[model samples]
Target: MNLKLVVMVFAGALLVSGCSTSKEEMLPAGDHSMLELWNGAEGGGSTARQAAAARESLRRPLTGSERQVDAQGDRSYSRTQEREITQQFPRLPNPDMVMYLYPHLAGGNTPVPGYSTVFPFYSQTQYAMPGERTEAL
Candidate 1:
């Protein structure tokens, strides 16, 4: 019984969808030009008169305050002026120390040259903060 009901509903849906595509609806009724619609010939019968009415509506003179706001509304002004802030003291360079390798055997009793490698003594970098005393001199 359930299978029969499902088959009947499926057949009804197919019949309804097949009836949507009629012969007349497949093509337009006449050769309607898009240019005529753009020039308002087919768009509501009359648009040139409507355009004149819209222009007349906006023909009023602007008030003094309104004119001032419109002239200054687009002109942008910065509240904060850009200026370089001079530091009180010069920036101190990070100190680097050289470590020398003593004359010793490198591999298989082979003597290696005493080469020195320079590295920073401190692991992390230190920066001076504002209003902080970094040096006495």
Candidate 2:
């Protein structure tokens, strides 16, 4: 009985999935011109003028407080700015190892200029977990 029910359910699922794809879906409807589709029933010059008008309509003169906030907002944010109170998970320092290589020839004896490159000491970088000892030894 259980085997019969399982076989029936599997056959039903297969039938439903197979019937989902129709002959009409497999065939393309009509040939559409690339230029006709790109223009999208509108002239390029009229579309550009409409876009400029929309932009002008969306913009307005800033208020006194908004102007002040706008002036202050520019200097307010910094990527390098450190927050003192938000040190829940302090970063463990990953010291970079700089190596200076002398000029050497390549496979075809191509002259390679002397340059300095930096690489981390550890193969995989690790972060210090919260409340872990991260101080320098």
Candidate 3:
């Protein structure tokens, strides 16, 4: 009888230890479900109103000093200004070259017959490399 009681206690302890609740599991299965329930059904005008209110809270009128346009209404970029702007911005790196291959049509200037050719053109530089090498045709 004592052994049976000890085995039952051990089994109950194991069951209790194995069972646990995680934060992610404790959270509701679907996100925004509660929000939708509180707001209304899908496509309801409440969402639009909430979005408009959020946008309004985020918006503010521009002051005179913050205005970008000048009195002439022309975008001001003199040679010196343009040079300064260019100096501030850095150029992006060149992308990898892409190659294309096509079947050589018969009756061309070359003597080869039933041969294919490749043409590789670098997209960013718009220049062709000296050799033809590409995995794709």
Candidate 4:
């Protein structure tokens, strides 16, 4: 008799533990739905229009106080300031040599001097494999 009672109690406990209640069933008494919080009736059609109107009413152009201007005017950079900027950031030696586009090879334009000159150390023969060697011809 005691064995049967223990088995029944275990089964009951398992059943209760496995049961789950949904969110709506678990909610506290007097809790409101999302529609109620938004001041709209449940399943209402006019809620979208009301929401858009509310958003539109919140929009307004910025006033003079909110507007921004360069208050320093042209007084920020004088001749002395310009000279200091140039001294700090010196101009490149050859700005034209820094070409962004590759010129056509057949266009008959010789590459600028120093561009075609290969470094002597790089041109020398170097062993690529255990016994194999290669050099720029």
The predictions' CA RMSDs to the true structure, in order, are 21.1, 22.2, 19.9, 21.5
lDDT of 2 at 81: 32
Superposed Cα deviation of residue 87, candidate 2 (Å): 1.1
Q: Which stretches of candidate 1 lie above 4 Å from their native place?
A: 1-31, 48-58, 75-137
Top TM-score model: 2
| Clashing residue pairs found in predicted model 1 | none
Q: lDDT by residue for model 4 over 6-97, one digit each (tens)?
A: 99999999899776766667775455677684676545466766879999999997666554333344445546766775555543332122
Q: What is the TM-score of each candidate against the true structure?
A: 0.29, 0.33, 0.21, 0.21
Shift in Å, residue 62, candidate 3: 0.6
Error of 2 at 126 (Å): 2.5
* lDDT (C-alpha) at residue 30 in model 2: 47
**Model 3 scores what on Cα lDDT?**
0.59
Residue 114 lDDT, candidate 1, scale 0-100: 85
Give Cα distance to truth, residue 48, candidate 3, Å.
6.6
User: What is each predicted model's overall lDDT from 0 to 1?
Assistant: 0.72, 0.75, 0.59, 0.57
Candidate 4 collision pairs: none
lDDT accuracy of residue 26 in candidate 2: 87
Count the clashes in each prediction. 0, 0, 0, 0
Q: Output the better candidate (1/3) by lDDT.
A: 1
Least well predicted 10-residue stretch by lDDT in candidate 2: 78-87
lDDT of 3 by residue, 1-137 (tens): 99999999999998997768776777756655767756755554567667888999999887786575553354455446666644554333345444544446557665444534444344453322334332245
Q: Candidate 1 lDDT (Cα, whole model)? A: 0.72
Per-residue CA lDDT of model 1 for 1-103, tens digit only, reads 9999999999999999998897778876555576765567665455776778889998989999999998787554523232212244434456899899988
